[model samples]
Target chain A: MSGFCRLERDRSLATRVDGGGGVMTGALAPIALSLRGVTKRFGAIRALDGVDLEVPRGAVFGLVGPNGAGKTTTFGIACGYVRPDGGTVDLFGEGPFDPSKHRGRVAVLPQDAQLGRDIPLLDQLVYFARLQGLGKQEARSQAGWALELAGVTSRARARSRTLSHGMLKRVAIAQAFIGEAELVLLDEPTSGLDPVQAERIREHIVAQRHDRTVVVSSHNLNEIEAVCDHVAMIDHGRAVLAGTVAAITGKNEEVRITLAEGPVPLDMVKTALAGDSVDWDEASRTLVIRFVSRPGRGAEDVIGQALRTLLGHHARISQVVKGRSLERTYLESS
Target chain B: MIGPTPFRDMLLVAWFELKEMLRTRRALVVIALYLLGGLVASRVFVGVIGRLEDVAADMLQTTRTATPGALTRQVLHSDAYREALVRLFPNRNVADFLLGLPPIVLFFAWSSLAFVPFLIMMTAADTVTQEVQDRGIRFVVIRTGRVEFVLGKYLGQALLMSFVVLLTGFVYLAVAWRGLQGFEFWPTLDGILIFWPRIVVYGFAFVGLAGLCAMNARSAAVARALSFVGLTVSWVLGEMAYRWSDGIFGAAWTAIGFLVPFSHKAALWRPGVAGVLPECAVLVALGLVYLSVGLVMFRRKDL
Candidate 1:
């Protein structure tokens, strides 16, 4: 069991104590959620193959996958929405798929799910709160907090039918937070939103990242790029890439030297740096240099050599911009 | 914060359904129709009794000229008149005359019938269909378990349908109890106690029917139509078979009745002397079968 699963067990124990449902003391560790070698197959179609994932105590995780990549299947399995043909899931070191033990600690904003048209947004939140075992008044108060958490405090009283899709999305997010969940599963929290709404939702997830682990799946790579600290990309039920954002996207290094002079011809430089890569950007009058040397070779090594060559050509240098190395590696690898 | 228990989760799902039902105004309309239907049907029953009483009175007057006996007067008691007056309609042995009232009475019973399946559809319509449509189900890999989601959704729909069933059951019972001859209809405690339980049994049947239909379907429209068709077809088959072969199975007709919740409850109650089914055994069987199938399907589903 991972540390994430332990936390969920602790929360359940605490709840049982309060609910007078019999409490077990100090017997279980506090892990939020953990998965090991989970695999799912739909006849000939293998949706998730040998997938292992871990969500830490409090962090924002992003899942990026193309259509039919089993990202949703992974999500469903984690939340107990779907059963895996193989693998073990643990919530706070408790067995996976135990609705009786792990429900209050988990909240999910399912993709494209709309609330009942007749229910009020506030009522919907409160109802979810109640489901987490709060009394009516306590649930109502917590509902307000949930809406505020999702940044939709003003729309609490609005009828679900009257609200816009963006607002509805926010309500769904609010519901995810209603129980002060330790783990939040958000499926496309901002798919169809305008730029502003999308940003607001991203901000909400980020704000909550310090206390609650957020696992979000979205085709909107930009959203994941903006809010995720860790990311996993799936293609056809297998993980093509998985790691921290910096680790996955920062795999290679590139140094761009913007010069005050005209584009210095790199014919000789290209010939000399045979086995390496170099490109000159005319718009910025910058020469971008890329190589697969390694981490030990710093930007200073590339910069020093580039300058020496430029000086030999009597070229003037301006500012230098060294962007993400891993992004280049990811793109190339993919 | 409290951790979620199955009971709490069940309640949360039920609360959500109640809020949705109340907010939609459809619940209110259905309840109103039920009330109106119950009153009208009761009146029809009493009215038929009134006509029968008048006929009895005329017969007595005609017979008084020939045989001036006290037995006729004893049979025509004041309490009998009161029962007839209160009921406002005749209680006939024939099922058609009783069923001929407004859709409210005949239809409202099935209205809650509509709610259970519709609510189940509402809960699960988004299951695999919406996830595929929006490509959202992929996120579950990181935060929750797949089985948890399937079970959670199934439990949620079950909880919601149960609430609707109970509420509508109460409505049916309240109307039926009030419209009856105020305890005059059944003089024995066994009879009166059994009547309310029978109504409750009817409610359980609806819950099972709705849950099973909703679980089997992907769309709300399909769920509703399926439940409706299922109900009608089963009853038709049961009625035809029973008439043809003395209530024995006629080419799987009994199985058809099991498919239609209303028909099953009606048939179950057909053995009762007062047109009510003793539905304990049948209710338990239907509820368990439907709930189990629904849960199993939901757990295995992709969303």
Candidate 2:
């Protein structure tokens, strides 16, 4: 927990220094949604215990957790579907559940909510749009645009009951994007989708980050890492770790270089980067190098120097990958 | 875009519910069967009354004492019959109207009002429970307030039941008009239409009760069963109260009977529109109370 706090602090500080391009700046962006000391109890089971989260404006935030870790519960609270027993939830600095304050401002794709089985896809979308206060013509137009965005425009006339699970999920995603929602909460958007459809949905989610604040909750760490700029890992109804994806996963400053030939000599690689922590995997022909930049140097400088030295020693590097994966970070943190 | 107001959002939910109800094949089939059953029952009722009236007329002629009209006059002038008419129609002489009409029309009016509420209960039993069980309500709940969702659902069920009641009334009126020789179309129509407001109120009351059951139950089957049980319990209690009205516990039982909707079903048969207003108001109040309680429970419940 202390380690996560340090990372969070560092990420905040880093965001203040580096504005918009490389990593998301939490300090500069306004908080789109904040949950403070939110607690929820279902009978004797505490679904969320003092959970705190801050999703920044225009940032794709991911809520990752194992099953029963309260990700969906948190989503429920944010969408005003579930009332927290204790604590406060603010959306755009107002209570999320207050309809007059937050009605059209927030949209949510609940994890397993099925569309009306007897309603046509287009009618359902149009109805959702109308609920958001769109005029009839505008609602129809927005519904069409949403369907096109979700890549399900061709099946607009199909009844929801006839669509496959993946298609229904896509349509549900489309429904969330209808109207001009400022904040969108998507829970397990790609859970039942195949890899291809999941990838497409991820692309759509990423596309939403430009104008809308997206909070995605899923168990797919890789997808979160791929699409989310900021993430919080929850375990036991508590936020175990949270920050920019890069900061959370790249804190150790480790890089892996896969060689084209047999495992490089560990001694030679160590001699080249004498103070760095290096490990060699003989079977995969991969070398992992961990280093912290000195006052006058940076990570690129260190990696550049190591590469020059390794090449001078006749090492053939095939691929170079930066940072540890989110899976590894999640496993370690939770 | 701005979001809808509470009223607009509730209307949207009601519109959606109406569409869903109309689209449901089973519900449509049930409504059709109810109309058909009303027509068949109307025919059977007219035939039975015709036979009974003939038998009475034959006995009167053989005894050489009186005619059927004189007997009807005697019955209409009786204390129990006049009391019942005054209770239903405080302002008008409904006994005179009933005396002028054939017995079948009077019998059909009472029987239909008594039976339509059950049909409404059956039709609306699963309205909310199906959505709750399917988790379809989650989408609308997020968009609109839970209170709006409940109100919209109740309104939709009420509208559906009203439509079914009117359709059945039309069918019954048509069957009687064609089957009976001297059926005064306007008078019989006026007699049936007098009960329309009360019938609507009664239908809505049953819808509200069923909606209350539906909101609380987890499954459609359970909701149906619970709503049926609720209706049965109300009827049984009301009947018991009426039966015990002469006993020592009569006051208490009557007070308890009024708590259920069944006690007030006869209010629709009153003489004038103004005479039945209080009953309509009572039924509306009961429906609203049931709906309000359901809304509170639904809002607190974990979806």
Candidate 3:
């Protein structure tokens, strides 16, 4: 808690650098993956434009963006599928992206990349494990454990071509969890899954936060918000905003209260809550209160003051949202 | 955490590729065509030898016609066939030894030497590109080093080509058992043995070169076309070098021809292990050089 408080103070003073996505953080956990000034082009189309990202270790970092955003392309460069035309990438501060150097330490589930077509899924996982330097028997055991984590152990002997779309997606995810990788990057891990399965996958992702760094990109904003501790939102190859979930959503800076139809005593509530700025949205009859938070100033304290003032004014409050939802944040920025 | 376990990685990747190719339709078709070509070659060579036997029987006028083996052996054991073998071999003793074997075995050996290179090219052209096009290589290249991945592919295709060439020996045994008059077991087996390893070395040179094409191109069809163009360019360069051997351009043209696989085939035809062994080493060296160049380019290719 103390370390996070100091990190917040340092991040506030850090300026945005050349890359538009530069949300700075000071000496957090050892960064799991770092990209600096990365640029990429596919013919005349620019896929990525000087994008920079820092993924701290032991966090479920979400790469949130809309359709045709640079999230997948950024993953491509990190995974060495597409060589960046410019800039550098570092994994665990070790070195550049060489497959041998990064072998068992980094695992990636590329978007839409199929597994071995007719090979049994377990054997394919074993092949990947063996290449990562596991012995035959150990590779088999680890591969089985990965399949169980993905809940696909029943189809371990099935060929990839014979599986349904959701089954194959699970198999692909299973491969990423094969070895004892320190960092795992999954692109749309729960894309084709039903609601129940998607929730299970989200739990699996969050479970990795204890020992491994996980990075995921997806269109499902609710899942991202539910599972991710930190996030960086990009639009059209530029980082629009990035920070912890609390920081980006202004969870401490703002709270919204929906009041029932009554005499709207907005000025009385504003005067009662002295320095905070309050506004009313007529459509929803919700008060959006923003405050400048400082040390020892808890969000609970600000929310309590606002609630008391509104109750004293005899406003019947129906609902209260703690912060701006991630959906609204994405819509506003995108 | 990577270690100095490149050999282990290569073996694993190679085995995976070998299994993949075993189930590939392109490899199966190429193998079937090579076997069919062996059958056609056996038919054609056996007919030619049969006609020679008839001519010899007429000239000697030994109407004993009861012994087809005797007539065929006597005819091939003549000075005329010895001269023909001499023209094919660089050494006189090598020619004399080859003249003792059956004509169909010799012809089968020659056809495999001529046909196995194309088989390798066709099978290897899609080995890298199809994976790249489908992004399936993302799974592999991330697991193994780029050098090991490319080398694994070459080693996989090389071993499969060697296996396919060995299958030709069985093709010879099958055809000789059914089609020939006197198919001596030991001699026919000996000829097949000599031919298999030699042609495999020839096929090895082209497999690495075709892998070069596959790694450089993005589509399987383009890779196949490039491999054909690579083979054609090598052959045409060698032929042109020889055609102008009497001019001042001969030295440079011959040097250019030396860089390609086509110029190295003549040494493969030399008749014994001592004569052929050095060329086998050279062909392997040439294959490695082609592979080294391809690996440099493949490492730089995006995806």
Highest TM-score among the candidates is held by which one?
3
Off by over 4 Å in 2: A1-29, A262-285, A292-301, B1-4, B53-92, B97-105, B244-254
Runs in model 3 deviating more than 4 A are A1-29, A262-268, A294-297, A304-315, B1-4, B47-70, B87-90
lDDT of 2 at B29: 86
User: How much is the lDDT of residue B75 in candidate 3?
Assistant: 56
Top candidate (DockQ):
3
Per-residue CA lDDT of model 3 for A49-158, tens digit only, reads: 88889999898999989787899998888887788888888887865677655777678888888787767888888998788766677678877776776567777887
lDDT of 3 by residue, B123-148 (tens): 88878888888777888777778788
Tell how far residue B1 is off in model 3, in angstroms: 17
TM-score of every model versus the real structure: 0.67, 0.86, 0.89
- CAPRI class assigned to model 3: acceptable
For candidate 3, chain B by itself scores a TM value of 0.90
TM-score of 2: 0.86
DockQ of all models, two decimals each: 0.23, 0.37, 0.44
RMSD of 3: 7.5
State which candidate, 1 or 2, has the greater TM-score: 2
The predicted structure with the larger lDDT, 1 or 3, is: 3
lDDT of 3 at B291: 85
